[model samples]
Target: MSTTERPRILVVGGGYVGLYAAKRIMKKMRYGEATVTVVDPRSYMTYQPFLPEVAAGSISPRHVVVPLRRVLPKAEVLTGRVTTIDQDRKVAVVTPLVGEAYELPFDYLVIALGAVSRTFPIPGLAEQGIGMKGVEEGIGLRNHVLEQLDKAESTTDENVRRKALTFVFVGGGFAGAETIGEVEDMARDAAKYYSTIKREDMRFILVDAADKILPEVGPKLGTWGKEHLESRGIEIYLNTSMDSCVDGHVVLKNGLEVDSNTIVWTAGVKPNPALARYGLPLGPRGHVDTAPTLQVQGTDYIWAAGDNAQVPDVASRKAGVENAWCPPNAQHALRQAKVLGDNVVSGMRGFPQKEYEHSNKGAVAGLGLHKGVAMIVMGKMKIKLKGRLAWYMHRGYHGMAMPTWNRKIRVFADWTLGMFLKREVVALGALETPREEFYEAAKPAPAPAAAAAPAQKAKAS
Candidate 1:
């Protein structure tokens, strides 16, 4: 590394904010003044909003992720994790996917590591619960659900069948609610092909610790959503928590217990703990604290955004709140990234940096294919929508916001083709170990009868 070379800008985590921020910076920078590098464990950026549809077989898992290399052609993309950042030394310890650790010195840094699923030390949760945070998890959940149907159809034991058919979701947020609804709809449709498992035989339960779900949408729509899910035979357990899910047996705090093979955990997420190792200034909740301009406090060269940053919300000023922080969501992440990117260039060029401010646009959630709830805020008025129309709006908004044009077209194509094609419900449970069955069957057996007879004749002669 030459000291006289171009100033290096290192962006950590190739998530929604990292990808877009790097792209925005690269687009703004002129020929070779600074070098931008993005580091993440994955080479693709997952469009997480469509994960529920992917799990439900509405979209191909491949279509829901945007490849970083394709989108950031100008920036050097490194597939790795940043183990630690020495702010005083201005170096990041990066461990590549298949190599030894190396020190990456940077003139500027962007902390966009994002958040991880918040989990508790409950018994059997680590072993039994599944999450819907990534593309692989979405695909696994899809296969697991289909495999449950197969198990229920083939098994003659009533207890085993009952256990296989019951599915429990431990969160009532958008991820949990949308996932359960889509999966339930998929399972119901798949029952048509099964001779033994009927739609009514399967059970879907959604549990949340809060009094209401979809708090991003106001109270009225949230209440409507709870009622809507309950009317469809989906049990809603609000203001309750799961006591234990030991060995696929879920015990709720309300004294309700059930045996379920599939347990999806989407309760919530906390900032990635890896950020703390970087020695940056973090808030009480473990998120990097940033100024209103999206710059890391007390640092002129480092910036942070996305779920990992506590960016103050300037838009909340109308409500008489001062320095209100922004919430961690896709909408905020996307906008914050753009501002952070521009601010980076502004800092580099010695220009005035702009402040970050955006009011809540409300939220929209899809319950299933044609069901949803939305609350859109326009100035002083807040409008609520539900049912099929809201569902269309939900899909339309996310479909357009699905990132790159390549992925946008692919996602829309998946939705378009879904109208004419039948949903695929085949479970490739053995996908992880394709050769296990073959290897077991091909193991050497005892000597065959003909070989044994030949040996015996030779001995007798």
Candidate 2:
């Protein structure tokens, strides 16, 4: 930024796409070819697939995030946000964590702003629903769930106990299914320690508008998953959406209603709303439109990928599918990022750009510790797995897919230790407001004059 002489590459939103794309570009470019700069609100990139484990207390929150600065040492990492972009002038306005907004000029730009949690305007959702988008939310969810158990155990009133014991999860996809599965497992284990609370006393309900759960894994497996969860006493209402959840009262379209203190929303995600402010070509769903080569439409210097970009899936098209597009998942994001980086380098050097094309490899889902489902597609051959073996597939795939070697080793270590140690079920709900106790102790007490004024006035009367 100090000098406009050297070419600059700016990557916005340091998530999976931004982090991997920046690393790829830095690795490919020669010395002094171009400078790479990354900007995001957080200084770390979170491995989102591990969020479920974090929420279940299977993994520490810190290990799930990769420090952007440590990973991208050669690149300029700015902890802030890009408020607006004037692509006509090739300038972006950046607002740091604590500073005046400034404009940054870049020769090339990569939009990896990613997506945010998608939610409906359901009643009381904003106040009561919990999300699993980030590490903080995951940690908060863990504490809140365990705290609910405490509330159920300590309460004497039957209404309060029942309300505290009821758990509701909205959505049937990977996040909702996995979160409820792991959390239910954790609660089942934690019940052993509580004298009054038992696993049979708790009620878990999963509500989704779809006809089936885990549709990504096909109908047969999805049905199996539903049955498996139901056998464990989970109430799943498929094709049933939540009508309202006001004042801890949950009403479903199917006429079933319940009072619950916990309501989780993991329905879906939409592209970042900031994409509209960038003055770029967007798809119907508000994602940046990009070519197969990953360059933003109608522009050579700008590129986009991951959940924010509507990149055409060439492999699917080649396979005789029309209007095919890549799904917004970590698998595609990681692969698209490398291709985007290569295309950016090629564009800089006037070389031919390579088109992005990748076929579906497979899918895996973990139900709990030793339960899961996996479908592996190898060319024309398909392999299906379930139970403990499929659980291994889930762990193996995501464990290796984790960002860096440092992280991979640490995650594996956590799992190894988990096998030998007791599960940590203690709820640290105080983390939500860590400074509350300090503030209470450190705040100035009421003045003696203020305390004595009421007594003195009464004496005068």
Candidate 3:
């Protein structure tokens, strides 16, 4: 912990890329050889793939995120953001959660600033769009959906009930499809307890601009997924764009209109725009340009990876493809971090660096319980699965890949208990405004019911 002459390794983010990179560097380097410091806005790293389950109350939000300090004890985990990086002086402008901003000098830098939700100028998107990127959004989406159910149950107006029961999800990718599928499952289970609302009463709609959903799983499975979901009463709109969602009245390019209280935007994600301020060469889409060795192009002491780095895909290059790059998925990010970290260590010791080359194993997605899709590639054989088997593969793969044994066991335990117990249906809408009820109680009332009745009788008399 001494601010001595140790080489300072500054990791600009603590997400999947940065956290694992820092952990690897700390493990490979000897004590006092380098001072590894990780800076991020959040103190915990959210396991994003499990976000849909978090939204559906399958996994506790806490269990899905790992505390940075707990996981990276040897590394200095700072809860803050790097506003700017001065590469010339090798110092980064750190903006902590509180207090004045300061500069942290670095001998080596790792830019793993992950992406943000890609949004557009679509009206009401900024105001009404619910995201599925983080634990908060996942929890909020759960609460919002269930609150809609509460509105449907308590309201007598047909318009109000319909609006509350109408759930519109824009985007048919993993986030959109998995989210709607899981939430619909939760809603179906929940409807059994409602007096007026039935499973068929709620309208679930999925819209996407893409011609197909889950392109990672190929066209056949994507079509099957769409058909299976539709058979379950879920509506799918393909090759459609959202015109506007102003006032929760959704208007689509296909001439469809729905007054939905819930609008989940899982369209896509773009690289973090913060890279523009870092003085690093960025790709056309705003990702840092990284070499195959995982080092930032034209820089020896600095490296980048994950969703923010446009690292060339070796597998694609081998196929004689031009301008191929590693994808921004968890699979590549996790592997790239290890390669990037080792390269940083090698560069420190003036050793030759190894290039990062990885072909995707496959993709797995869960559509609620006992319903899923997967495409696993082993050698030349392509394995495609569906139904319950695919769902189990989806869970098993993500459960094992959920980082550290601490998280892996917890996630597996959740699944084990989930089989024997029902999904939790409690919606904590009060979390956003925990003190609202108390504040309302303390405020002076316009008139009590008794006082109002007596005054009315006196005036009438």
lDDT of each: 0.91, 0.93, 0.91
Residue pair clashes in candidate 2: none
Residues 431-454, candidate 1, lDDT per residue (tens digit)? 878899999999998999988998
Provide the global lDDT of candidate 1 against the true structure: 0.91
Task: Choose the strongest candidate by lDDT.
Answer: 2
- Tens digit of per-residue lDDT, candidate 2, span 98-179: 9799999999999999999999989988888999899999999899989988998898999999998899999999888888
Candidate No. with top TM-score:
2
Question: Which of 1 and 2 is the better model by TM-score?
Answer: 2
Q: For each candidate, how many residue pairs have backbone atoms clashing (under 3 Å)?
A: 0, 0, 0
Candidate 1, residue 148: Cα displacement in angstroms equals 0.4
Off by over 4 Å in 2: 1-4, 448-451, 454-461
Candidate 3 residues 1-461, lDDT tens each? 24647889999999999989998998899777889999999998999999999999899888899999999988888888999999899999999999999988999999998999999999988888998888999999999888999999999999999999999999899889999999999899888878999988999999999999888789989998999899999999999989999999999999999999999999999999989999999888998998999888899999999999999999989988899998789999899999999998999999999999998898999998889999999977889999999999999988887879999989888888999998888899999999999999999979988889989999999
What ranking emerges by TM-score with the best candidate at the front?
A: 2, 3, 1
TM-score of 3: 0.95
